[model samples]
Target: MSSYLLPAIAGLLTGAGLIVAIGPQNVFVLRQGVARRHTGAIVAVCAISDVVLIVAGVAGLGAIVAAHPQVITVAKLLGGLYVLVLGLLAAKRCLRSNEAIAANAEEAESAGRWVAVGTALALTWLNPHVYLDTVLTMGAIANGHGNGKWAFAIGACVASILWFTALGGGARRLSHLFASPRAWKILDAVVAVIMIGMAVALFASI
Candidate 1:
């Protein structure tokens, strides 16, 4: 038990560090959080996805994935295309930025829940960077712990849950600041840039 302590702490810190960075998923979560739209569902999706990925990585799927170069090539191509499309959509939203402010509960409820769910799934599963971080890098680190790998995975899973919960739930506090359409436009523009940049980077690496 004592031996697992260090690995658990290491996994927690590593998971937090990797996830806290600004990315398309985080941006989407932040936007949903500020809008108070399906924030709980989004957070659950992200946390569950991370848990599944982390489990796969720890269970040795990482090594198998790494062995298949073609799989990664395909993932890169698809992921890049998906991200590019999302970036374009975000840019378009910036152009028509009337509804950028926070939505009332009724408005948020009326919005298509399926749309949000689909977008969340795409932003998560279509990002090759997620595979690289959670599978390859985190897998390598977990395997380094030998028998303690499961402990590490648990810590990492916890980290994901905690981070997404805080990010999605705490964003409402800043709702006043993003109340303006202009602020939302600017935010979308930045998200567009980041998503496009990530897409470009993905293609370049392939």
Candidate 2:
């Protein structure tokens, strides 16, 4: 019991360190959370995706991925293009007034569940950083524990669940502040900049 406990705790801390950063996935989750649209599904997709990646990493797929640079190169190019489009869309939204933004929200709500889930999946799976962090880095660390690696994996999964739950669920508290059109515009503008910057970084890497 103590064996599992120690490794699990180590995994929890290590996973938190990898995930709690400001990335494209975190940005999308926060936006959906504030809009209160398909927040649950978005959170679920992100967390579950992490679990799958982490498990794969622990299973030694990370080593295979590390050996294959072309896979990551493909993901980087595709993900960069996708994120660039999202950034441009957000920049367009930033130009709209309060009423238009509100109407857009309403329209989004009607069709956003699946859309949000799709975005969540793309942002999670397409981003090469996720592979580097969760799969390559965490997987290598977990293997060091040998017999306790599964316990470590469980702990890392738990960290992902908790982080996404808190991020998506707790963002509602800021919804009141986002009620103003100007606020929405500002938020969108920031999102655009971040997304674009991330896209640029990904392209530059390749």
Name model 1 segments beyond 4 Å from true: 97-109
lDDT of 2 by residue, 148-199 (tens): 9999999999999999999999986778888878988998899999999999
lDDT of 1: 0.86
Steric overlap count per candidate: 0, 0
Q: How displaced is residue 91 in candidate 1, in Å?
A: 1.1
Looking at candidate 1, the ten consecutive residues that score lowest on lDDT are 97-106
Error of 2 at 178 (Å): 1.3
Off by over 4 Å in 2: none
TM-score of 2: 0.96
Backbone clash pairs in model 1 (N, Cα, C under 3 Å; residues 3+ apart or in different chains), count: 0
**CA lDDT of every candidate:** 0.86, 0.92
The best candidate by TM-score is 2
Candidate 2, 88: how far from true, in Å?
A: 1.2
